[model samples]
Target: MVEVADTAVRAGLSGPRHPADPARRREARAGYGLMSPALLLMVAVLALPLAALIVLSFWTQSGFTLDRTFTLANYWRLIAPSDREVEWMGLTFRLAYPVPAILIIKSLVMSLTATVAVILLAYPMAYFLAFRVHRNKAAWIILLTVPFWTSYLLRVFSWKVVLGYNGAINSGLMSLGIIDAPLEFLLYNPAAVTITLAHSWVSFIVLPIYVSLEKIDRSMLEAASDLGDSKWKRFRRITLPLSMPGTISAALLVFIPTVGDYVTPELVGGPGGTMIGSLVQQLFTKQNNAPLGAAVSLVMMLIIGAMVLIFLTLIGYWRMRARRAA
Candidate 1:
């Protein structure tokens, strides 16, 4: 028995198992079989459309005609510098196409603003649910989600009615004699768009954050308190760091989709509040420039991907420093 045990250990430590092993091959085949359906769905839903978009971006459109011949004109038009220049903050930029560039910047700024607002507003609610609520917690979660149960369009329209020049807010103010006239600046602006986006996405952000806060080990918190740590210090050192995963996830969930949202912006965002998604819609539908629209769509997607990568990198660096300090 001793000899047999020693022989088995020696064989196990000899080297890693070869990939050509029959058992390993069988497991790989089974795993692939299990994943085949999802893989097929991804290919049909995501890959094919992406390939078509890429192919379309290389082609040019003329009056009711799509030139199937490949050319770089569409891409060149996006990047080709114009004679025009704009100066901001003591720096001059020779813009390629000012319209698209401006719209992209506007979309990013609005999206980031909305994302930050969502996080700030959501954290307190999530904390309350996680820590303060002991009874009927499920009911509270249901109540939080109730607003989202209604149609998204209805919600936006409701905000419109509230914020419109002669809407609820203005009417209430007039009735109370707080102001003689309605506030025209309440609706149909970038602020309106940002507000709508933040409110629309806040409920979804709460669940993840709540789950994160709930999962924190109680013993560590208690230990901190016993060791003379204040409530804020405990939260700052332990709760905040631990809950970052959910907070970051919630931010991404809000940021990515809102950046590409055209409907909310279109309804609330007047001409001055237009975003890159609105431009893509116009190019595809109104302007009949599918190639250029496809190019813009691809560019927007690339920018979003890059931004998400940078955000993740920054978060990872922060986590590394925190871990080192600990």
Candidate 2:
């Protein structure tokens, strides 16, 4: 046994010096060398901005000048009530302090709603593209993506026109005698904002799910059928589980942007649809509260980070359970 162990150690040490081993090592080094540039680019472009945001969160800026002093005042103000009094619209409004928890909760609700809506719509579309549609898929995908080629702002504005009282939808409905007058509850609401956002983000969700579903082997379905499984059974037991990673990915993609979005809520939401993003913008632009705005921005980032971490943890736990069961 000692001789065998000694021989194994010798073999391991000398393995890389062999003709084939040198070639394999060279290939491995080349692959890593090629990836190094991309890794550096990510660190510069993505990581740096996040780090700067974190630093800015702790910083206090007075007017155009930035103070490099680090203090917990920004974070403290976020949680503690402010004694400052202010007037708005002829009424005295107290700056009773902003609750970070409330903002975080509202952002989560909005993001989660939009994500769920996108997933619901994307799942059927992805399933159809993967299993039902074979011919003209490229053309169909192009058609789906054509909306993106146009200005995002224009697309959002178009929804406003459609939902407006004097807009095409109301006009058509009124002409058809579907209603006595234009519906007042259609636009300038949370529903409109959510719908517009979900519609705009549908492509993001569909593309990832379609890619995942496409990678699934056709033989797996046939094999399940051969074992007397119905379509629903096969989808529930096999397809849904396999496609979960894509769903989770799609949720992240939709949720992140929606949470930070100021445009959709501003354009469509009017008053009732005001999100934390709008609140942050108000602090910076209207109120000129840089320190407060920075605090809010930092809190928003932390909330988003927590959400992402929770989602990733859940996905990891589910994956581990599935692996163990398998």
Q: In TM-score terms, which candidate is top?
A: 1
- Expressed as tens digits, the lDDT of each residue in 65-165 for candidate 2 is 77889987778876765566554325443446644445556666877898899999999999999999989999878877888998889989999999998
Residues 1-326, model 1: lDDT tens digits? 22344577985664247677878678767977999999999999999999999999999998689999998888788777867897643545576766776778789999999999999999999999999999999999999999888989988888899899989999999999999999999899999999999999999899999999999988989998998889999999889988988788888889999999998999988887788999999999999999999999899999999998888878778779978997
Regions of model 2 farther than 4 Å from truth:
1-48, 61-68, 81-95, 99-101, 322-326
TM-scores for all predictions: 0.90, 0.80
For candidate 2, the 10 contiguous residues with the lowest summed lDDT are 86-95
Task: Give the Cα lDDT of each candidate.
Answer: 0.89, 0.81
Off by over 4 Å in 1: 1-18, 86-93
